[model samples]
Target: MAAVTWSRARCWCPSLLQVFRLPVAKLYLGRPTMRASQQDFENAMNQVKLLKKDPGNEVKLRLYALYKQATEGPCNMPKPGVFDFVNKAKWDAWNALGSLPKETARQNYVDLVSSLSSSSEASSQGKRGADEKAQESKGILVTSEDGITKITFNRPTKKNAITFQMYQDIILALKNASTDNTVIAVFTGTGDYYCSGNDLTNFTSATGGIEEAASKGAVVLREFVNSFIDFPKPLVAVVNGPAVGISVTLLGLFDAVYASDRATFHTPFSHLGQSPEACSSYTFPKMMGSAKAAEMLLFGKKLTAREAWAQGLVTEVFPESTFETEVWTRLKTYAKLPPNAMRISKELIRKNEKEKLHAVNAEECTTLQAQWLSEECINAIMSFVSRKPKL
Candidate 1:
């Protein structure tokens, strides 16, 4: 029998499976038959609905294939057309099981569901513990209202500098907002500064050497930015004050950016001996000219609100005194629009470039991983921490 090519199936499918991979077990011959009753399969199906979190795309696909095999015996239906992306993926997944017996498929399905439930319970406990601490710290705040979900960076004293936990928090928040009944999502920061960017301590506090630390950080950073790129709903950035580093770099991925007149945008990658990330290398030049993008990314030039607006980086600028009121009012009205219409329209607009963005994000993160391991980057980070500069 032919083995399943899961990697190819995952790449073609525009689904959650792209986030992570799950191991596939090889099929063995002369295995003892394990009979699974219909009631057992039914129970497993119900259990899946009660899962606290999604089992991710790969697992879901496996479950789907197994379920189909159990119910229908085999994938006898004709394959879907290429343009039928969803059905094509579903067909491919189910067909990969080949001629596995229904009883075997049923048994596998039950086993998978049981494993998922047990793991889910353990994961929930750990998540609750981490969430409790995050709540107490109030480092990141997430709230939904009037069809709009808001994710706020709350560490004003630290200029909302992002920590590893904050990165995870934001990624989770964005993931939740993407599937929730929200028409739009907005990013903002509390207090005077929008965001001071990554906490240098994130690097300094690494338990492993630079190479290992850089690898791990790169993985997290890639997922963080991927969350933004794959968000289905409209994403808006409210630049309340000075925005630096990744915060500024990521604005290029937002559907719209509203900045206060006092707000500033800066990406000082070279100063830190690092390369541009968040796909800014692609987005920056595309938004403005290469020379201008070079000035900000390569030479550490910062832009005022008006300057950013002129460069096509910002949607609009509001007076500092009335920024919040103005931005909120507009967003509330925007939220009143038909949610599905907005989402589908956004998807249509992004379809052509979505693949490109993902490719660019991967390339940027890989490059950044190397830069993070460089001696110059380590020295710059150490020096910055030693000075204890006010973020």
Candidate 2:
């Protein structure tokens, strides 16, 4: 359970944050400095059982001891009188595995326990207010005398849902315009949505299935985010209607994101039974707390423009009626700036934010890739692809 702890140890988040808990037994066995993620630990756990299977034997027992020593401090600092039956059972079971070097394992366990500091324990139940899905979208297009470069995902037919070709087009257009001295600033997204990100069906099929596609998507989106993270010139995105999943996540990497009043926002990954990509792991939590970010990432809930604004995650929102006009007007502001200044500013800001962004992208990729290879994730993808579209 390197990347994650056991679900049992994990706080069951009916809503909001689910605390991450580790089973006291064998918790300390892995390299603590490294976040093994849930699947990493599970894979190793399974392997241990396979190769070192002794029911109530030494491998399992040593694992248990390691877990106890590692988590000893985190579990409310191990009270002498509060020792419970579960601990006793784990101890008994652990005893079956011969004790090796307790001190050496202790350090590793402590490291594993420290990793959970990044995990939040708060829940919606304890909060004073509650809200569900909220979202917004707008179109950012610039068609002035300078140069014409429009990026629109506002295809009304599919609610502006993106196709694979659309992403390729975006990359191509951005790269081209950014490189072309003739073009000053690039316009992005249009209509009800700048984009709704990937077409899940096409994505699933193209990658052969969700499990296979997830890893691939993670890698691709990481690169995609990097492209926008620091384009030479200014970029203005018009987000209209609802922008969910990768659409919302990627927007965070943009310099300026504008949306309509009715433009809702969300990362629908969890609802879709998927993990987040597009470097959201670091961005989300850094902008929002672990609890808030986890709510979006773990639950796939949508949020309103006002809600996003409050969190400072969104810059501005316009009414639906004037969304298009507002988007262009807002973009014109950036277009008005000295093109060279805008370019340098974008680059400078990105350099400042680079480390954390890369760290998050790296973490998201690691877990996403590992999860893609799991039976649970693979099975889920098969089931999803086999199902008919909802009416």
lDDT by candidate, in order shown: 0.79, 0.53
Query: What would the per-residue lDDT of candidate 1 be over residues 20-130, giving only the tens digit for each residue?
Result: 222221221112257768898888887776666565554676777788888897889899796755566567667766788888888888887776675666966755564
Model 2 lDDT per residue over 28-56, tens place = 23323444444444444343323211212
| Model 1: residues with Cα > 4 Å off, grouped in runs | 1-137, 389-391
Among these predictions, the greatest TM-score belongs to 1
In model 2, the worst 10-residue window by lDDT is 127-136
Number of clashes found in candidate 2: 40
RMSD (CA, Å), candidate 2 to true, equals: 20.6
Clashing pairs in 1: none
